[model samples]
Structure formats: C-alpha cells, structure tokens
Target: MTIHHHPSNETLATYAAGTLDLGRRLVVASHLDRCDACRKAVRGFEQVAGTMLEDLPPTTMSADALARTLARIDGLGADESRRASFREDFEPGLPACLRRYELGRWRWIGPGVEMRSIVVPGANDVRVFLLKGAPGTRLPQHSHSGTELTLILDGAYAHEGGRFGAGDFEEADESVEHRPIVSDDEACICLVALEGRLKLSGFMGALLNPFVRL
Candidate 1:
C-alpha cells in the first residue's frame, strides 16, 4: 500500500513523548502499524528523548520507587499475554491497533456512507469511529472544530490535500474544509479520531448535522 499522507511532525513527536490524548494516540498508532517511515521517525524521537534523559542530573528516588517499578514491570508480562491473546482473536481486515477496541454497530449517516463508533475507555469528549464510504460516494463537506486524524484501513479516497490510499494518515484541523470522495472500486474504510465536534457545511449537512452526531 502506498501512503501519501502522514501525521505532522508535531503530532508524531507528541505521540512519541506519550503526550497525545488516548484517542489521537490510537489513531497515530494505527497509522504507525502500517507506515514504516513514521515508525522510524517515532524511534528517532524516542532515542532523542532517551539521550536527553541520560544527560539530566541524577536525582534520588524514594525507597519504594524501585520496588513499585519492579512490581509494575512484572505485571506487564501478564498484561501483554492477555493482549496477545486478544490480538490472536481479533477480527480480520481491521488494523492491529483496533484489536483492543469494541466496535459498535454500523449506522447509516448519509447516502453510501456508514459509521461505527469505536468504544474507547475514558474518552469523554473525543470521538473515534470507523467510517466507510462506498465507491463514488462523496462524504459531507465539513470542517472540524479541533484536530482530526484519519487513518485509511481499506480502499482509497481523495480530497483537496490528495488521494489517500490504504495506510495513508490524514491530519486536519479547523483550517481545512474539503469533501472526500471514495475513488476505489471497493468501499473505503478509515479509522477517524476527532478532538472536537464537526462543523458541517452546506444546507443539507447543517440540516442533518444534529441527527448524524459525527
């Protein structure tokens, strides 16, 4: 799969530093699973962080800190085992990063467009979902109130930015306003993370916005 779009440098840096919110982090992780270039960039950022830490002045830790850390490390083994088992039973055709999420039933949002909410624990205001567009379908024209990250999982779509095929990651904000149309023969499926509510454009979109809840 050829990926023409990717998360911004700032986004990738925040992700590597563990500073991105859970919803956005999940979106970036899903993209990284398929984009080797972004994976390398994340590793580079991690290495830089490690080197910076090594250069910092030493600080004494609490007596129980080491014990607590060791205990947490031990617990991770069991947690990883459970995660491995879960991944083994994960649904086919979905990104590996989505294995841990609970997918809600798909609901029709517009003509040839369907969306399924992704149940993300502790995600209060943020929304995550799987959006599928049938071939030749044009998605609603809208802009976001905050950052939006979209990771293509199957097929392809095109917007003002460019054509996004499987494995492409598109990052948009309030400044962006474009309608995406699926271009592949098959349906286009993408994992989307929205930091804030969408601001629909046009009369039809505004009329249906309240009911759609995207």
Candidate 2:
C-alpha cells in the first residue's frame, strides 16, 4: 500500500520519547505498523535518543538496583512474548496495535455513519473510536478543539487536507475544518484518536454533537 500521509516529525519524536499519551501513541503505533517509512524514522529517532543517554553523566545506583533492573527486564520479555501471541490471534481486519484495547459495540451516529468506541484503561477525557462511513457519505463539517489523529484502515476519503487512502495517517488540529466524504466505491473505515471534544459546525453537526459524544 502507498501511504501518502504520515505523522509529523515532532509527533514521531514525542512518540519515540514515550511522551505522547496512550490514545495518541496507539494511533501512531497503528500507522507505524503499516508504513515502513515511519518505522525507519522512529528507529532513527530511538538511536539518537540512545546516543544522548550514553553521553549523559554517569550516576551511582543502589545495591539492589541491578537485581531489580534484571528482574524487570525478564518480566518485560515475558510480557512481550504474551503480546506477540495475542497479536497472532487478533482480528485480521484490525490493526495489531489496537488488539489490546476493549472495543464497544458499533452505534449509529448519523446516516450511513457508525462508531465503535475503544476503551483504553486509565484514559480520562480523551477518546478513541473506529469510525466507518458508508460509500458516498459525507461526514459533518467540524474542527478539533485539540489534536486529532486519523489512520485509514480500509477504503478512502477526501477532505481539504487531501485524499486519504488505506494506510494514510492524517493529523489535524484546531486550525483544520473540513468535511470528509468517503469514495463511492467502498466504505471507509478509520481509527480516530481525539485529544479533546470535536467542535462541530452547522445545524446538522450541532444537533448531533451532544448525542454523538465525539
């Protein structure tokens, strides 16, 4: 698949530094799984981070620090093995990064539009969901109150930002305001991570915003 859109360098750097929130991290991880270019970029960032750590002044540690660190490393290896096993048995249609989350049932939000909430443990105000639009459907025109990351899982849609196909990752902030319309050929399924509430515009969006909880 040809991925035209990707996470910005700043976002990737934040992700590599483990500073991005869980919701946004999951979105970026999903995109990275599909886009090799982003994966290479992330690896480069990690290498730089490692080099920086190596250059830092050395510090003394407690007597049991080494033992504790070794134990943690062993536990992490076990956790990774379990995660790999889970990914192997995960749903084929969903992204590997999303397999760990609990997905709610799909609910209709608008004509030809359905949303399924993904519950991330300990998540507060932020929200994550799988949004699917039927062919030729036009989503409400709206702007984000905070950052919004969208990763296309299937089909395609077009907005002012560009025409996004499968594997495309779009990042939108408060400045963006556009209505996305799914192509006529097939339904569009996307994984969306919202940092804050969506600021919907127009009569239709206003009427549905409160009920949609988007």
Model 1 clash pairs are none
TM for every model, in the order presented, reads: 0.88, 0.88
Please identify model 1 stretches exceeding 4 Å from their true place: 62-91
RMSD of 1: 3.3
lDDT of 1 by residue, 1-214 (tens): 7778899999988888776777887788878878889989987997898799789999998999878755543322334335733544344577655667777888898889998888889777789998999999988899999888999899999988889999999989989998998995989999999988888888769777988877
Q: How many backbone clashes are present in model 1?
A: 0
lDDT score for candidate 1 against the true structure: 0.82
Q: Judged by lDDT against the true structure, how good is candidate 2?
A: 0.83
